[model samples]
Target: MAKSANPLPPRILRIIQRRRELGLTQEQLARMAGFSLSLMTKIERGAADPRHLAAERLLNLSRVLNLPFLHLVEDELPEEEAETPPLKVPLYPSLKEAQEKKTNVFVPLASPMIPLGATPDHLAFFPFPGPWLVGVGVPFLKQTGYLLVDLRPLYHPQGVMVVRFGEHAALVTAEDLTAPKGYLLSFSKGLPPLWPGDYNPELVGLVRKFLVDL
Candidate 1:
């Protein structure tokens, strides 16, 4: 086998070793990090260097792995012109374009307060003051909280969902497409009627779990 060209930091190597010691799979780690499985695969193989991780993702990896953030810090490696991988960004001129070309697409799922950039084994926490969740009426979450929106359950009935339509975004209880779903974006108002036309909004993901502070 050809010797790997990328020399990863000791800390980065330790992360992989520890995860295996704990018997965690790359997919589990990616879900914990709120990233796609492909991202985790790249990181483990040193195809995606930790030095390239965003600040928030760095913190997330530290928290999830129980490793100190500073201890794992490493300077970026210089990329050889021929060895650099093209950056994948999600952007599309229209919904049709996004569904068609399926390349260089970017989605603004992260918020300023709560960002998503971490080892695929970390949690993507959104810090929005949300009544974005429904069905679970824990009093502790009445004030402020975070939600784990899993993209895998978009079709699950009664599951909460995060949706975007042009400039508007909302969290709502999902109902049959034939029936109207209520928008939970507002905290002070009564259940608002969601027009059926709104059903076609960009389905970001399903609300899998939530955490809140009283």
Candidate 2:
């Protein structure tokens, strides 16, 4: 009699193969996926289930492998278990505070810059506070409200600015400082702490710039 093939999902095999193709050790893959090496090893061995963000991490790994996202889920799900929803836990106390206050945090709408996708629930900061404009994406947007701002002018001036969206706010910055003063302005209408006609462009810009930079 012929033996039946192993029943693990394609995602598991893809993870194993992709890790090898990229020359990534399990430790490297784990760090990229925000998981521990032991956890990754367990999943590869089929000793654990990949649910919620685990699935997302697997998807991301597939991307790094240049494989199709659905390639990981090629097998039918077990009849008894349905796919789980994405986790919406807050990663910071400020997000929790914003949610408790029932206020929304404003964030830049850029897809790559926003970790929670197009519609985020937490307020996120950018440029991550440094000499250079480096930034980190986060997933705590579900706990706070979100908004997007256009920072084209600021980018030219190497200037920074702040703006409010619902109950949350963000600071934006540029890489150069040669842009004209007052060239940047908030365009969000009906936003609170509403910048009156006499708004302090420099101070507002500085405040918005520093908050996220920190």
Candidate 3:
């Protein structure tokens, strides 16, 4: 079959190949690589945020697949940017606290986060090592389901985000995913977003993957 003029980068293709060569399912790879199965799927599909794929987890994936780090990401980088160091993922205070204590990070189900300074309140906590929780961004426990949320502000185009609108929390989609600080399109006119206002939205976190038990 003729390949499309625009093909997935060789880096992504190799990840899929190597995982299959090792006879590992995406979930197995996720557990081994210390990330989420959803993230593994996204990585293979070339849909994850560049920052997520460029962070240390990718390095872990290379190690797992017995491949060099650059083999998976070199094609994604520009010539001048190739030599730049990998981006360091930041841990939210909650995650940092969890990592320090060697326990599952407690995720709040509905507490709205103040992205600038104050911490959001949590209604309850779930103890999953965030298998996908330990990715490029900080993890917030705001949603009920085990959906993985990225705190780094990295996101997909027109992605869903949790934000503090005045005193309450709102799930808002990005007006333009390219700019993290861009305006957020709101769902209703009764809310603070008010039809794409001129101001930047305060971000709580970006939602990506989720897990649920039967």
Order the numbered candidates by TM-score, best leading.
Answer: 2, 1, 3
Span of 10 residues, lowest total lDDT, candidate 1 = 106-115
The per-residue C-alpha lDDT of model 2 at residue 147 equals: 22
lDDT of 3: 0.48
The count of residue-pair clashes in candidate 1 stands at 16
Cα-based RMSD of the predictions, in order? 14.5, 15.1, 14.3
Instruction: Tell me the deviation in Å of residue 23 in model 2.
Output: 0.7
Question: Which ten contiguous residues of candidate 2 have the minimum total lDDT?
Answer: 129-138
Q: How far off is residue 104 in model 3, in Å?
A: 31
202: Cα error in model 2, Å? 19
TM-score of each: 0.35, 0.36, 0.33
Residue 80 deviation, candidate 3, in Å? Answer: 19
lDDT of 1 at 44: 77
Which candidate leads in TM-score?
2
| Candidate ordering by lDDT (highest first) | 1, 3, 2
